[model samples]
Target: MIRARQLKDWLPITKKEIEMRGWNEVDVIIVSGDAYVDHPSYGTAVIGRIIESEGFKVAIIPQPNWKDDLRDFKKFGRPKYFFGVTAGCMDSMVNHYTANKRLRSNDSYTPGGEAGFRPDYATVVYTKILKELYPDVPVLIGGIEASLRRVTHYDYWQDKLLPTILEDAPADLLVYGMGEQPLRDILKAVKSGVPLSEIREVRQVAYMAPHVPESPDWNTVELASHEDCLNDKLKYAANFKIVEVESNKWQANRIIQKVGQRTLVINPPYKIMTEEEMDASFDLPYTRMPHPKYSKRGPIPSYEMIKFSINMHRGCFGGCSFCTISAHQGKFIASRSEQSILKEVDELVAHPEFKGYISDLGGPSANMYRMKGKDESICNRCQAPSCIHPVICSNLDTSHKPLTEIYRKVDAHPGVKKAFVGSGIRYDLLVDDFNKNNQDGNHDEYMEQLVTRHVSGRLKVAPEHTSDATLRVMRKPSFKYFHKFKEKYDKIQEKHSLKQPLIPYFISSHPGCEEADMAHLAAETKDMGFRLEQVQDFTPTPMTVAEVIYYTGVHPYTLQPVKTAKSPEEKQVQNRYFFWYKPEVRNWIRNRLTKLGEKDLANKLVGNTYSHSGNTPKQHKKNKSKRR
Candidate 1:
């Protein structure tokens, strides 16, 4: 079903492509840190397509060389309106380094799965280059890197508190969160002749000015200045509480923070996008493939993974303390109409590479599609960061009927042999012990459908941690609910005579987790006959409660001291518990736990059966090599 595509199908990425379009100058030039993949899953493509859909000439410069003469940036020359800069789908530092700050060998967004294409602090680096080359031209920055760093935050890679990204990048403006609505607003104003620096009324944007703009229409909340935060950690921690609360609200106040002489103004975000607006963004004329320029370099790993997948919705209401989804995507869900989703399904099925298998059809959380508060007025007056945390909201609608119908319809498609839900599901939502809103037995029906049809042999979920103390600090439900959910999942499996296992994800060295907590987590999951394949050592990224706690040694919401493993040795010791089944580390675990007076916990893990031998280690290594 695939056909030869014209060069003009995608947004222009090269000078020749722009020339082919017969445009003398482009209205916008997007400089990105990721290889240009013309898919809705990629932010650069979405923004570029939005610009083109708005009737502006937009071209992209993907992964421009920062070390060279900067010709890649200059290739497009100056855009007629402004230069759009993004550090791509992920933050540059996160993409470049591992949790231990070791350099990563591969970049998923790069062709051939290679690293070293994008520099560290890519947004700042790219913007600096553009500002130096074209000082008179305006530069605008957005994406996860800019959105999460819009306020003063702790940069884990640098191991220090940093000011707003606007100060470092020196861009004219920043459009935070999902940029569709704010981007359109800016485009309209610019087309109407409003200067970039003068358009200060757009929502979901942050910019620096000499003083606060006078706006009587909205209330403003001033955060601790960058200087004050450097002098006092508590002040910095306090600032995060305000930022997170306001970010999740319906009618949020404008946030202003002083950084040196200039004031960083973060306008309140736009209300969650309606169904129509969400559809328009996804319904753009995306070629649904990487630009032809990268065909010789090899496939982009991230693009290939999601090429056939569809994102049914946006945003997450879970608001886990360690996560950035609710921070960057907001707390409310913006779902696409089923018509738009099916339309994409048809397009995906036509791809030559799609062999009747859809990789995934999910969003931030798989089950959150078409979910939101039932009463608008109640949501408008609420300020809580999480909707389903602590307890599900009374006015919120948690019905799974719409999602079940969508799945059934997709399964009925003759082109699709199977549609897998690869995205991690929020298992806590389906547990009757935790969620009281499922009185209509929608939960049972949905679980049956999902377990029977959607699971790809192993269904993935995140219990995060087993310890109640650690789970409380993480703002997650009790692990007891996970046990309940597993029981139900097992029953559903038995009913269908299926053999799909639940893959529960866990974290070590999180903000409130201790060495003993990880020990308990290992033993608990081990009792359930799990080898613990999915696990990670926590990395403190910017704009999350865990990061703030890791830096300040206290909870932002309660200001209570919370213990965190900081030193490399301490973190390594905690992480070892996740792999208790490995014989190589059993002796180490036993010794460390006994030293900490946790011999009982040690017995549960190593079971007093591990002993170090002079030649056993060599024999074990030889056996491992033979298997390989």
Candidate 2:
């Protein structure tokens, strides 16, 4: 038995540190692709801390040198219980390469934000290395990479349907989703002397077996076989539809897909964490700082950005086709109690580095803290991926009072001078025209509170695209809703005499979006006095409906053909529209729009006619009207 160390600031990493803690053997050794950051926002730290809280001896090996003589894998020898492998917070391929398949020069998760610290497919690499060194030790993989790739899915980098990570890595188990509940269950089963091989009943876990196990308790849903998907794109598309629906359901059934001779079984996920459970997870002792070892190497950019931020909930019901938050975090909101949130705020106030400011008090969506389905039975029976998309669900409680109250409580902190909602707000929720059945009828109050108190200088919201056709494909509401939201936002700003900018974020080159659509977006936003400083070219990541459409050229739900900018040139041309004001791109935009027979759009975007003040005459008049 390993003697437990008195709770240390961070988990032990080196053998010397392990020995100093009086641990001859650790129950779990976590191997990660990211540099160690002992903050709750970082997954490795959270998981390591949770395991330590369970009274198990846990140590971490972060950014292990996979190219070396395998010393990192052998340094800890074999953990007594299991080795947890993760590709850090992001998928490894996404971390290593750009959407255009070009290698990135920096990784924000690293100590110095440098790239190439970890290998491509870091989860598979680390787990395979561990298994090669210690075949007897159990290896379990988790994190964003494993969670999104837990089933047969399209790999954008590889441009093929890859089997689940379980088939690729020689791991005994794979944990998916938020991981806290499933991890606790795994720890309990393992502590009870259940062999890792036989721990198949744990929820949110996946493993391979020679044949499907007979479990009378579970109702299993088999997906398209890996062979069938490989042979036919339609089968592959159809399979994703099943996987996505099962994933978002409240009471999901077990999912099984055959891969060659073995059967891949994914146990249903744990129910959404209750308020108490969410509070408990956040209340776990966290230093909320990067491990001291990275002091000289420079700060992890990702950690620095959110060190002072507080996550109020876990899950996004928006279910944007391009986003994986719902798939990984779940569709329901698991919010922290107000007390728990206030306690965290108080702790931030006491931190030596704190400067009378709480960076952010938000989650996946800032205003979704306490929002949920008004009727529990309706939500349980519902399989819709988004509660707000297409239209806000009638059963969803779109009230923002609870969120506003939380903001008020945080702002009331004597030590906190300001608490900003850095996360993007679902503007549709606050628009009366968009959310017609808002039960609380406090949309104006919520918007007023957010704009006057919570916003630091600018409030950010994602309109994504202006085209209703593309917006529908993206699972986002119509752009008209955004216009209504902006009208309300501008009215509030004028009423309060505040000059806070309502920044809207947009995406270019998303699935089903054409260059013509992007040009229209650029023209419309420009007409509305937006130069579009916040914009991104859509990069298809794994396990998103957008990615499925991008790779397969078909919508997963309807099996209809969808157009995507596949080539670098196609994507670049679409992205150029976002920067029509730039001199270098002005001619390029004019020529492209002209070539596409969109002369009017080109004139709107980059017409020669302009006022001496460098503003178009029409734009000047529109800006003047806004001042009135």
Candidate 3:
């Protein structure tokens, strides 16, 4: 392992850095919406490092000034191969705005957590600037914004169905999903004297074509036209079902869709990375620090949060309807070898800033490391979006032994004082009694180890909602599983004589969740003695099942109509339930419940006579009618 001090600095971000590297011109220039951070967690850094590993000269122009004379885009001039543009680690709109459509005051990706570093629709804006400045240079767009908005889909901010982003951004190619493999192929093809226009056969890439030509070798599924989706909501809902299913499959068919006169063909993504490949990607020589240019601007909040953390794996199998991890990272889990993880731990120990405490040793889901299908052939042919939702698939291997062992090994390091799993844990995976077939009776062992060692007074898990109906719509398991897991967790804490808290996360204003449902959730959790602090009003981002339901009024999978809180008043009403314990919201909650003729729930939530001390009366009036 490379010692932290011996690691090379960040990639060239300016002409001086390029000259320092003894290169007059670069082969590829990456324009990003985020401030340049040379950590593996940053997408631009990873892509740049991968290209550099291929012996290609690469440089980044991060969060460039697009409002000026377009000098930033011209600083790097034209690349020998292509100009790679990304809206950074997050979707630009999500980074810029809140769920309530209010402009966010801070961007975590920017240096010093400043706002307005990148413009709205950053991918489109950057690509347009590069194309206009260097029209002859081919531009390839990737990252979350381009990946999620590759095809015609709903745009919640605009409140309409917009066509493929390619229609708006004049780019030659769109590399979607985790882009290491496809990018390597694209680079190889470019090195072989192949034009960008003719490199359409690469996987995980989408390109605009003059016409829809027949492919005799590959099977294709054509989606509803952009015009049809724009004209009809039902057609739009149906199109998302195909897009989602194709995206999750192991061997997906090539998808073709038309937006106006152009035909957009999105090839299937590369298969899940092997253990060696995942290790190699993480093992790349990353300085793991923000660029020195931002030293005077104060530390990046996001970087500080995870500087000492280790990402054990990629992707999620939970496939929660409201989440987009599966949409971009794929449902299959790609984990690093034990050696790779330990090497990173050693590197962290050597860092001058690290104080022997590792912030996180987890990924999308903490306990899903080294977990996958029991049979390779079964997984290859499987089209299920989630391996552990609704019910854990019988073919899935949900053992926690591997993860527990890794934790113990990391803790055994003399240089490390503690290693926490900061990512949200899928509690259902620990319910061995509940999921008998998939588990190996090691649930208690894993739970005890985690609560006794890793947790720092609190462990977070997402139950999402209390209502079974809403959980189904969210593609989450029943709340009963949370109760079961909580029982086990409490038992383990008592055994260890520990006082750790099991913090459950929930979402308000989710699809299929009514105002009454939110009230029920509040009452149920209150009975369990929880004043929820980790709750959010559902944000409808692109390429999520809940977003599709929110925009189209129908579930993509079942064409069944779903009710969503769209209006500001409607969403506010749902959000109020999350704060039922607050004195200010108690009266409003009672009034809304009384109007809905749920007097029993009203009294249960806030006593007939509410108090201002943030506490409900000990004795409450009983209702004549039985509870619904």
- Top lDDT hit: 1
Best by TM-score: 1
Q: Which residue segments of model 1 deviate by more than 4 Å?
A: 610-628
Relative to the true structure, how large is the alpha-carbon lDDT of every model?
Answer: 0.92, 0.87, 0.89
Model 3 Cα lDDT, one tens digit per residue, 67-149: 86688888877899899999999999988888899999998888889998899999999998888888899999999999999
Off by over 4 Å in 2: 1-7, 608-628
Tell me the deviation in Å of residue 287 in model 2: 1.2
lDDT of 1 by residue, 66-176 (tens): 996688999988899999999999999999998888999999999999999999999999999899999989999999999999999999998999999999998999999
Ten contiguous residues with the weakest lDDT in model 1: 609-618
Clashing pairs in model 1, backbone N/Cα/C closer than 3 A: none
| TM-score attained by model 1 | 0.97
Clashing pairs in 3: none
Clashes of 2: 0
Ranking by lDDT: 1, 3, 2
Those runs of model 3 whose alpha carbons end farther than 4 Å from true positions after fitting are: 1-8, 610-628
For every candidate, C-alpha RMSD to the true structure in Å: 3.1, 4.9, 3.9
